[model samples]
Target: MSENDIERLQEVLRDFAKERDWEQFHSPKNLIMALMGEVGELSEIFQWLTDSEASHLEGKVKNRAREEIADVLLYLLRLSDVLDIDLIEAAHDKLEVNRQKYPVAVFKGSSAKYNEIKD
Candidate 1:
């Protein structure tokens, strides 16, 4: 069920888009670009906000961040739909590979990748 959830979600999104005739504009390239655009927008929300200050932000700023995050995710969901990619399974697969590339023992305390650590 976990493996199929993203596909199911994509299907629901596709249906919703179809209902609104949005499929016509959901080309793979456009969706991918839009996904990046949303990411940039989301990042810009905190571009200069200090981490401590950001942590203290509430209400409107938080809501704006949530909306930006949602926009990024929507574009990602639609991008997955356009590419026929199963994001849940794909995410699981990525995590598995990342586990090997970033074992906890070495990468846990730092942000460096397994390959970047000194042997």
Candidate 2:
């Protein structure tokens, strides 16, 4: 998604919370907790599914997954806004760090952690 999309969503979430008088409850810690809850809900959709089934969700299950994912995104965006973090930039920076930690030459086709990858 574009930065504009993220900014727009942030504005929408800000207005939503303000309109509901929920700013006080939107602290970073609370938002993170809510995010984790959403994540759990999302995970539940695939809890007993085979890998193929989880990858190819359909009908009601897919719709539920969509809603749960939206919840996760909303809570994450709210938390980032509360903490004054630019999520896009932070993600880019983290990706760069990960690239350095797990170089293509050493990490290709490997599922090992960075520390476990042989030189």
Which candidate leads the pack in TM-score?
Answer: 2
- lDDT tens per residue, model 2, 15-114: 9999999998987788888999999999999999999999999999999999999999999988998898999999999999998998898889989999
Give the clash count for each candidate.
Answer: 0, 0
TM, every model? 0.85, 0.97
Cα lDDT for residue 12, candidate 1: 87
Candidate 1 accuracy as lDDT = 0.83
TM-score computed on alpha carbons, candidate 1:
0.85
Candidate 2: C-alpha RMSD after superposition = 0.8
Number of the top lDDT candidate: 2
CA lDDT scores, all candidates in order: 0.83, 0.92
* Cα lDDT, model 1, residue 119: 88
User: Which residue pairs clash within candidate 2?
Assistant: none
Local accuracy of candidate 1 as per-residue lDDT tens digits, 29-97: 888888888889888879899999777868888888999988887788888778877788788899999
